[model samples]
Every structure is written in structure tokens, then in C-alpha cells.
Target: MLQIYNTLSRSKQGFKPIEPGKVKMYVCGMTVYDFCHIGHARVMIVFDMVVRWLRTSGYEVLYVRNITDIDDKIINRAIENGEPISVLTNRFIDAMHADSDELGLMHPDQEPRATDYISQMQGMIGTLIENELAYQANDGDVNFAVRLLPRYGQLSDKTLDELNAGERVAVADGKRDPLDFVLWKSAKPEKPAGTLWSSPWGKGRPGWHIECSAMSCDILGEHFDIHGGGADLQFPHHENEIAQSEGALYGKDRKDDDAPFVNYWMHNGHIRVNEEKMSKSLGNFFLIRDVLKSFDPEVLRFFMLKAHYRSPINYSDAQLEEARAGLVRLYTALAQPAPKVLETALDPNNPWAQRFAGAMNDDFNTPEAIAVLFDLASEVNRAQGDEKQLLANLLRSLAATLNFLQREPTEFLQAGAKDQAGLTAELIEERIAARVAAKQAKDFAQADLMRKALLEQGIVLEDKPGGLTEWRRA
Candidate 1:
């Protein structure tokens, strides 16, 4: 059985789906105003690992990661770029897919866009109005009444008084309370044309927080098995979701008859650089595309899994280079050919597999699970015949659960270096041939010089038995 740390409970608990053998998970996805940064990468990769593990654990998972295609950021970006909102969003959406493909992320089962559910959002807002949980302010904006709902700060574990004192909360003119958040924003005269919708509150758009509440409940029902996002969202965004969703479901009386909005809440920690949070405003943020220019996508993925999901991971060239070196070792062990064997299920009874499963079960502890892979790799290197083949298969199968080590070892090793350097395969082969000739002629100094030149170009040569030599990227 898998145990996950529930952010709401602040402790690890056994995972039990509301429906046996089934899970409905909703994760807040990208805003799509620009290219995804490393922070966004963490969210996508973390949840992708979770979904993969659930399916591997024999549960049917309905994964929905919603896209915020109609947010204020999207609108502003479209205006700045002088493109239609759809045009801007569609471009970034394609870019997001390219990035995701490069990173080897499994697409979510359902990717609900915010614009597609406008009617549902309006309906939910009306329910809040009818129950007096929300009200139309003098400025024609609809706001959720935080004071009206008892236990408003349950998720953040902060009282109304403390939240009021927090400097982050803005006191707008029309809002009754400073802590109250907008459910619907009235259209401004300068707002984009398509951005506004005719709602009961007037011509306006759904607020950022309300979009998720409506979309998640509309797609996954009023209550679901799990809700996940980055830890940054736990305070205002997710806390607001809980308030609005549960308020609409149970009404002002706040009865507990029906199911809770979400059974478990999970949050992945942030990515840091030099012990500071990685943010574009701080000049420390790296775009996924920018990072991929230098490091392989698999290397970035491995770097993230090297740390526990809930722990902060630092981003640096040194860290990525280290991860690249580690991947090379894993692939090197897989370079040797193994005896052919019939396909079979991953043996849960196998000790190594069991150990891997145990680490994964204990809150998706990927670092420890990766250690198990290294152990299997050691065994694969030492064993021969069927034993070696079995260990290699086990290594591949377990690593695949975390979406790693799927490429052919030699191909992965040899492919990328040439791209990094201004060299071609033909050039590398010619150099290798020259080095071989020099060695055969016993020109030891010439052969050594040739090797040094190739090494400087990021190509490494390995001499094997029977006068055979192989080369790969450094």
C-alpha cells in the first residue's frame, strides 16, 4: 500500500481512494502566458511520477490537469504581443506540448481549459449568491464572503485576524474584508473583447481562483480523491478553492453530510538557486527550453528526482552536470548485451523489486528507489547468462516507473555530444579511424594527440578487445 504526505493533515497517511481501485486527481496546470520555467517543470514532472506510480500499482487513475488559458496574464500577454488571445494561448500551448514531449511527460487524461467551462463557473457563482456565501459588490464584482464562511482559514491554518495582518493581502475599495477574494471580476473598459462574458454579476470574467473550483468539481464531481499543486498555491489559491467548492456543496449551514471536497492534498516543494527561490523577477529563473539547450531533458528529470519531491531542489550547472554523469553510469551498465528472455510481469516477489516498491510506497521516495536501481545495475554488471538478463530487465522496468532509462544505452550516449559540439558523425568516425591507424603503426605520441583532440571536442573513445574501439559523447 502507498502512503502519501497529505498537506492538509501535515503527516503521511495511507492512501484510500473514495472508490475502490479508482482515483480522480486534479492538478493546477500552467497559465500559458509564456514559456514554462523550471518551477512549472517540477509540478508537471512530480504529478507525472505520481500518476505513473498509481497506474503501476494497479489503480485506475483519472488525471485532470487544468489549463488557465483565460487568465489576466494571458490577456495582458496577448495585448502586448498584439495577437488574439487564442492565438497567443495556442502558441504557448504548442510550446508547452513540445517542452512536455522533450521532458517525457505523460499527457494528462483530461486537460480542461478554463474558457471551455465558463457556463459552469457562472452557475457555481450563482449557487454561492443564492446561499449568501458570495455577493455582488458596489463595483459590480462578485466576491466570496470570507467572514460568512466559518473556518475560512482551515487550509492555511491561519485565523482571520492573522490573515488580515499579513502584508500580502490587498485591501481593495469594494471588498467588505481585506482577506476576501474575487470570485468574478467586472470587465474594464480597456479589457480585451473576448475576455468578457455575460454573467449574473454583469459582463465580467471568472476570477483566477474560481476557475479551478468550477472546473475540478464540474469534471471530477464535487468531491474527488486527491488535489495537487506546487506548495506556493497552498496558501491563497488552494485555500480559496476549498472555501468556494465546499461552500457551494454544503451551503452556509456547513453540514458534513456529503463527502469532503478533496480527500487528500499534496504539494511539491519549490526549486531554488543558491538557496534563493528561482523567479524571473530575481533573474535566477531558467526556462525549460533554455535549460534543454545545454543539458539533456532526461538529465533535468533525473536531477529533480535526486531530491525528495517535498524538499527544495537547487538548480545549477554543476548539479545538472553531476546528474548527467550519473545517468551516463546507469546507461553504461546497460550497454552490454543480455541473453534473450520471454516477457514477464515485474516480479513483486523479487527482493530488489520489493525494495523499490517499498521506497516508492513510502511517500514516493524516488531517491531511495533510484538507489535500488544502482544496486540492480551492480548485479547486472557482475552476473552472466539468464541471471544478467533478468537483472537488466528489472532495472529497466523499475526505472520506467519513474520515466527514466528507456533509451538504448549506446544511442543515448553517442547522440547528443555531436550536437553540442560543431562536429558531425563523419568527422568523429574519420578521427577515430586516424587514431586507430596511428596506434597500429605504433606512433604512440600521434595516437595520444588524436585522442586528446577528440576529448577536447566532447567525444570520448573506449578501446575494447579484438582491436575494437567505440566512441560516445562525454
Candidate 2:
């Protein structure tokens, strides 16, 4: 049985989906106002690992991640750049896809857009108003009646009496209470082209809370198994979702027929920079692309999993460089030539892979799993005559099952920027020329030196049945 840390229960609960052979998962996605950062990658990669392990253990997982195409941030960014809101969000969405692809996150089974589900959102808002769960003011702005929803503060552990948002109460004719959040914000005359939809209340845009509710219900069903996001979303966002979803279903008088919403909730820890909180005001934020320019994706993954998913990750250049160096050792060990893989499950004469599997099975402890990988590397480097091939094959086969060590051995051994072999054809030609000059001048010493340097850097030279020195990345 697989056990997972459920944030809702705050425990490692056994995973049993409502359906027999399937699992449903929903992850809150990017707002599409800016490039994705390492914090976003933490959530994405953590969930990707979750899905991968579920599939590895024989569960059919239908993963859905939503794109918040419309939000205050998106509109402001549009205005700042002098572009249409649609154009701005689309550009960021494309950037999101590229970054997700680079970081190795699996494409979600469904990616619902907020703009496409405004009708559903409006319908939910109307139900809330009818059931006294919400109310609309004179200005046509609808707000969620927090006091009416008895479980308003349950998810965030806040009390209804002390609901403090640190913002002053505004005098709006439509709102009955101050704690009530806007379910639909009435479009103002000044902002003509931001976004708006016709609802019972008035022409307005859906609030942040309603977007997730409508999108999740529309795609995954009225109820689903898991709802996950960053740790920061536990409060108002998720709290509001639980209220609107369950309240709407109950208000329809389908108490029993109401689909049970997310049975489990999961959240990954935040990413910090050098132990300092990464924020725009602090000027310490780094986009994932900028970080990727200096480091390999796998090294970043290893760095992330080094700490438990629930623990904060402190990012720094030194930490990533160290991870890269350590990763090289393991990948190189697997990248060595593999003999024929044995058909059946046996001891395999190496305990590293078995140790890895056992660690992975125990509550998806990737840190422990990675420790096993390091142990395998230690064993490989220490092994002599009889033990080498068995350990190498074990590492290769295990990595095939778990994608942590997939790169070819040559690629794995590369350490620094210098490890990149021959950046251009001109560099290759120059290196070749140096080698030829050394050999022709009878300075065989220099020629042999250049060849060894190239080989060490992962450039394999072949004196192929052709008279030319053929070269390729190993």
C-alpha cells in the first residue's frame, strides 16, 4: 500500500481512490503574468514525481493543472506593456509550457483555462447568492458571506471572529460584511478592455476563488480525489474553494448526490534563496530559465529532492554546483556499458537498486532514494574485478525504472562548463588542427596530450575506417 503525506489530514495517509483503478489529481497552476520561478518548479516537479510513482505502482492518474489566464496581475502587466490582456496572458502561457517542458514536468491530462469557464463560474456565484451563502451589493459586486459558511476558516486554522486580512474595510453599498470576499467584481467604467462577462449580478469578471471552483468542477467533476498547490494557498484560496464547492452542492438539495470534493490535499514547501525569502520587493527572485542557464535540470531536481518535499529548499549557486558534481558521479556510473539485463527479479548481486526501490516505496521518500543512488556510486568506484559489471548493470536497470539517472554515461560524467565538448565546429577544427600539427612536427607528446584531454572532456575521436578523425559527444 502506498502512503502519502496529505496536508488536509497533516499525516501520512494511505492512498485509496474512490475509483478502483484510477486516481484524480488537481494542481493549481501559474497565473501567467510572469515567467515561472524555482518556487513554481518545486510544485511542478514534486507533483510530477507523485504522478510518476503512482503510475510506477500501477495507478491510472488523471492529472489536471489549471491556467489562471485572468487575474489582477495579468491585467496590470498588460497595461504596463501596452498589450491586450489576451496577448499578455498567451505569451506567458507559452513561456510556462516551455519552462515546464525544460524542467521535465509531465503535461497534465487537462489544462482548463479560466476564460473558457465563465458561465460555470457565474452559475455557482448565482447559487451562492440564492442560498444566502453570498450576496450582491448595489454596485453589482457579489461577495462570499464568510459568516454564512460555518467552515470558512477550517482549512487555514483561522477563527471566524478574528478574520484579519490587514486591509481596511471599504464602504461598498453591495457588501453585507467586511470579511466577505468578492465572488464577482463589477467591471468599472475606467477599465474597459480588461475582461468582463455577463452574469445575473452584472457585467464583471470572476474572482480568483471562483475560477478554480468552476474549472475543477467542469473538468474533474464536482468532486475529485486530490487538490494540491504551494503551501501559501492553504488559506483563502483553498478555504474558499471548499466552501463554494460543497456549499453550492448542498444548496442544490443534492446533499447525498453532491460529489465529494478533493479527498486529499498536498502542498510542497517553499523555495528560498540563500535562506532568505525570494520576493520581488527583496530583488532576490530568479526565473527558472535564468537558473537553467547555469545548471542542469537534473541537478536542480536532485537539489530539490535532497530535502523532503515538505521542507524548504534554499537555493544558491554553490549548492547547485555541488549537486551537479555529485550527479555526475552517479550518472557516469550508470552510463558505462551495460551487459545483457537479466529477465527475472533476483538479488542481482547489488543492493543499491533494491535499496532505492525500498526507500521510494516508503512514503515516497526521495531523499532516502537518492541516498541509495549515492551508495551505488560509492560501491561502483570501490568495486574491482568480479563486482564491477554486476553493480553497473544493477545501476542501469534501476535508473531505467526510475528516471533519475537516464543520461548517457558520457553526458553524466561532464562536470563544469569546460565539460561541454567542442562548442562549435570551428572549435573542433581548431582542436583537430592542433593535434595534426603536434603529430606532424614529431611532437607526438602534444598530440597524445590533446587527444587525452578531449577524451576526458567527453569527446570521443574515432579513426573510423575513413582516414578522418571522426568526433562526437560521448
lDDT scores of the candidates, listed in order: 0.88, 0.76
Candidate 2: list runs displaced more than 4 Å. Answer: 167-174, 252-260, 338-354, 383-387, 400-402, 418-474
User: Tens digit of lDDT per residue, candidate 1, span 1-474?
Assistant: 899999888899999998999999999999998999999999999999999999989899999999999988889888998999999989999999999999999999999999999999899989998889998888888999998887778778888777762566666668888888889999899998799999877899999999999999998999899999999999899999998998998877876565778989999999999999988889999999999988899998999998899999988988998888878878877777632333324578889889999999999999999999888888889989777877787788788888888888887788653266777777889999999999999998999999999899888899999988888888
Question: Best candidate per TM-score, number?
Answer: 1
lDDT (Cα, tens digit) per residue for candidate 2, span 1-474: 667777766788887888887988899998999999888888888888888877766779999999999988888888889899899888988998998888776899999999998899998888887887888777878888777776567677778887775553344676677777888999887664558777777788998988998888888888788898988888778888888888787753435455556788888888888788777778888898988886777778778877788888888988887777777667656543443454223253446656765676676788887777678777777776557777776665554444566655554444343325535545766898889778779998888889888878666665544446756544
- Weakest lDDT window of 10 consecutive positions for candidate 1: 337-346
TM-score for predicted model 2 compared with the true structure: 0.84
Candidate number of the best lDDT: 1
User: What residue runs in model 1 are displaced by over 4 Å at the alpha carbon?
Assistant: 165-167, 256-258, 338-345, 416-418
What does candidate 2 score in Cα RMSD to the true structure? Answer: 4.7
